[model samples]
Target: MVSELRIGILGAGGIAERAMVEPAHEVEGVRVVAIGARDPERARAFAERWDLPKHGDYETILSDPDIDLVYLALPPITHAEWGIRALEAGKHVLCEKPLSVNGTTASAIADAAAATGRRAFVGFHYRLHSFTRRLLDVIASGVLGDIERVDVDFSIPHFVVKPGNIRLDGDLGGGAVMDVGCYAVDLIRAAWGEPAVESATAVLSDDDPRIDLQTDAVLRLSSGAPVHVRGSFIGDDQGAMSLRIEGSEARLAATSVIVPQWGATLRVSAGDGLLLEEKAAEGDNSYARQLEHLVAVLADGSPSILDVRRGVGTMRVVDEIYRAAGLEPR
Candidate 1:
């Protein structure tokens, strides 16, 4: 069990900077000391930008005894190989989602973790956000009554114009569903209960039928509540990362559900047909809270919501969605 966790980032991508290194200092006894990438110069530049103590090719950080945990921000195609390697090297892993290109490959990471007695966590940091807690609170209070359905929309234009962006390349494990739909699907499962996909369809890119530019899936909770999820990458007003829960007695809606750090609003309304409750999301970035959770998991035996096993469960659903859409899973 690690008391002080020294982290090495496995990629020099934007997420490693924004999601891992930037929020790391907020967690006690956790420091991002090193970074490694396929390109040594990119890794060195990233390390210098973040003022990290170590940087080099990917093997440099993996072989470092000082790196107790590795946060993998590499492209989805590389997660399984490196996650397994890190676990075998006696280092815990915190991998970015979708964990891997598909569910079957993702399960190997869990297998690796179990065999090595090293934990592997998936980075679904949004679950640690304050709005999530508030959403749960309202549910537990029964103010929303019996849930009737959940609707989620998460889309961004980040890669729409970048023809070479990984998200637009099928070989890089890219797709609208894999990149953003995972969040929508995971959010419902966490905030409510496990769900089973009912039907799904996709709008494939003109250049690549395997690459979904947009995906829409319908799911049902064990409790019989329906879920409508839409993930997009090319359109404005598709679904700007919002969630709504319509219950028998009331309705709850949240804006900016994905990155509440940029500011968010949660509103609940009932029979009166007016706003009954309103809450604002404000707090540390969920990434910091996630790091804290990782520390606790290492210090003791705390279970993690971000477990790779759970991530595999999510990927299975994603794979099902892809199959239902008549496309192949990465």
Candidate 2:
């Protein structure tokens, strides 16, 4: 059996409690060695529950000699600072999505990781799903002929209403575009192989002046294809999240694109009026699979799918979207 990777969690927030702490315990080649949080009581409680070593400050965990990896589940604004510190401390890091609040910070962390010779991975867990992998293959294979246009919708319910949640604040790197809209941008770039954003137009709501709670933009790609993206915090809980690509000879619609827990549905309509649909098998834990991939890559010294370079590009697009909307990135 492969040696279990020793992991230390930097934050015991909701994500750490629900996704990392629980599922990681179930993986064979993984072990939770330590946890750190701002609150001593809370961190200790989490460690007691998970049977791990707990610390009130992140540096305590970082200094531990037994930990092999560190997972940063902190706020987006703090991602770069903590990530850099962890890498300099000689710990491999798996940072949560968006990489950072903007492209500049993202690039800084990426450079730090490269300089340290330490493995760096992002928590773009959607890329780990088998269904999404197969969809990427189909798109790259050109089975549907030349691409024409792409329409994407990424939305979620109002899940966070608490005060100072960090997700709704603009200065702390919170917004509809920064949150749910990232998926739309990344998936489009992945399909197009490059983000040739010639121009963009966006509509913002007035309810939240601090952030773009509702944003819809039209982006032009290098291939001369027009892609429309709609991301919002005001959509219904039952709203759709998928990408529809119109090609020369066929059209591809990826149903259940955002929330793969509902299972993925792919539909292809050929020029001859024939249509085909298929559903992707579901897994209980995407987070587990993502960690598994990180461990495997670290073991073999292979590259990761969502490495720092890709994350920097995604953040750059996000910075552009914010600029087009007449809002300076926070």
Candidate 3:
């Protein structure tokens, strides 16, 4: 039985395009029925472009009876409010990563979803990727022995190149931490359970002190394994999208953990002898995998992978990192 899942998008943006609109077309039994943006004209344009059947404002999607799932592709600051609303409206929610600007709001959304008995998921698509599972499997197999420390980073030149991008705007829940760092934080939490933010510091943009141009944070898991997470928008190289795990027995390194649809490479070594090396075939979209999970969760009553509780936990680390860095949380 192919049970259909109807999706209503609350934001007409690039992420909605990449993570939902585009993937919705490829995945079976998933339909993006409606799309809404603050700008009605933009929503209409996006609807037409994506071949969505309907378009309107956020309220319209929430009010629709047939829209069983609401995908909140809005900014971090807006996630909690609308996520709760969609949950209350009898719609499950798939919010873009970060969940919210701070842990408090994320917790509120988690509570609302719990109260409503509705599923709410955060969009950390990479967590659903095979690269992540393989990395974890390698470590769990004891090939890496006891984890000593982990290093994960995702950086780009968006700060220098993409002028006026929403991610660079502080008031709109913009910052390197809120934008890209959440993925790093989530990956760390996924690899090593919840962590305590030991210390954090960031290079704030001279123009916008509220926005971190580059963030370097250190966290300690309960197992005493240390994690170094670096997220940046201003960078010299193409990007540093990789993870390194140092253990008592060996070292595991992975590249392109973020979007393996682009490319994925892995290397395991110890004392200069490469134990293993491999590359994943390109073209598997993590977003499509995520959509399939969401659909299965709804249809078969399956457990969610990135549920609200995990989202709130990730945001707690993010907020703690902000406090440790001497900046306000979002």
Candidate 4:
């Protein structure tokens, strides 16, 4: 029997409650032993609810010699520091995305991972979704031929309404681009394969304390494929999130691809008629899939499907996009 991997979860917040603990409990050969939070009462409550051991400070979990892994569920601003510390402490780390706020901190985290020879993974959860997996397989198979263009649309109307939510504070690494917009950017990179950003432009809300709450940016890839991305946190309603890939032989429409409805079929049309249409199985929660992958990397030294190298590359592109848009790092 394979031994269960011991895991420590940082940040006993909603994201952890929804994305990590709840789903992870179903995966075999994984054990979440400890949960950490800044507030002792909050941490204890979360721990009791999840049936997990409690730690008031994050350092306690990282310094625990028996814990094999640490999950960083904190804000974007805290990712780099905790990631580096965890890696140096001989613990593998799985950090939630954007990896870090900007390229500088991301680079530092990547450097620490390299220097420590530790397994580090990022939580770009969308990539593990069934619809997206199929999309990647189709693109990589060259069934659509040489790619010409890609269009991505994203909008989230109901963001955090908490008065002191880190997502709204620029100093705390808050912004549409860093938070939600990065998903579109990441998808573009996954499709284009190592493309550099040519330029970016953004429009901010009137007297907005944070960076632009909406962004429409055009990216010119080195492969000559141009990507158009639209993202916003404030919208009339939640706009449709989709991706259209135009290639030499035909065009593939991934309508409502981002949050694909379960039991609904995804159609790939060839303009003349339907080419492929299939309903994806809503099996294996993405959080579970990512955790399994992280465990495989730690247990047998397997390569991470979404490792730090990719995380750093994604952050660099986002950093450049911010620079082009005249949004200075906070």
Q: Give TM-scores for every candidate, taking all chains together and pairing residue i with residue i.
A: 0.95, 0.92, 0.96, 0.92
- The Cα error of candidate 3 at residue 164, in Å, is 1.4
The worst-scoring run of ten residues by lDDT in candidate 3 lies at 157-166
Where model 2 places Cα greater than 4 Å from the true spot, the runs are 158-164, 198-208, 271-275
Q: Which whole-number lDDT from 0 to 100 does residue 219 have in model 3?
A: 90
Which is the better candidate, 1 or 3, if ranked by TM-score?
A: 3
Q: What lDDT does model 4 reach?
A: 0.76
lDDT of 4 by residue, 1-330 (tens): 126788888898788876678777787778888888787788788888888865667888988987887889898899998999999999888888778988788888889988998777788876776777887788788777887898777766644333466666777787778877777878877876666666666766454555677777778777788888776667546454667878887777765555554332456667688888776566646667666766666777766667888888888878877777787754
Can you write out model 2's per-residue Cα lDDT over 137-210, one digit (the tens) per residue? 87887877888888888866555433465776766788878887888888887777666554444544354575
List CA RMSD, all candidates.
1.7, 2.3, 1.6, 2.3
lDDT of 3 by residue, 1-330 (tens): 227999999999888998998888889989999999999999999999988889999999999998999999998889988999999999999999888999999999999989998889999887777776776677678888898998988888653537587887888889888888899888877766888999999998877789898999999988988899998998765787889999899999998888876778889999979998877666678899899888888887777768989899989889999999999998
Candidate 3 residue 158 C-alpha distance from true site, Å? 4.9
Count of backbone collisions in candidate 2? 0
lDDT of each: 0.86, 0.79, 0.87, 0.76
Q: What residue runs in model 4 are displaced by over 4 Å at the alpha carbon?
A: 158-164, 205-208, 255-265
TM-score of 4: 0.92
Mark the regions of model 1 whose C-alpha exceeds 4 Å error after superposition: 158-161, 237-239, 273-276, 281-283
| lDDT measured at residue 164 in model 2 versus the true structure, 0 to 100 | 62
Instruction: Sort every candidate by TM-score, greatest first.
Output: 3, 1, 2, 4
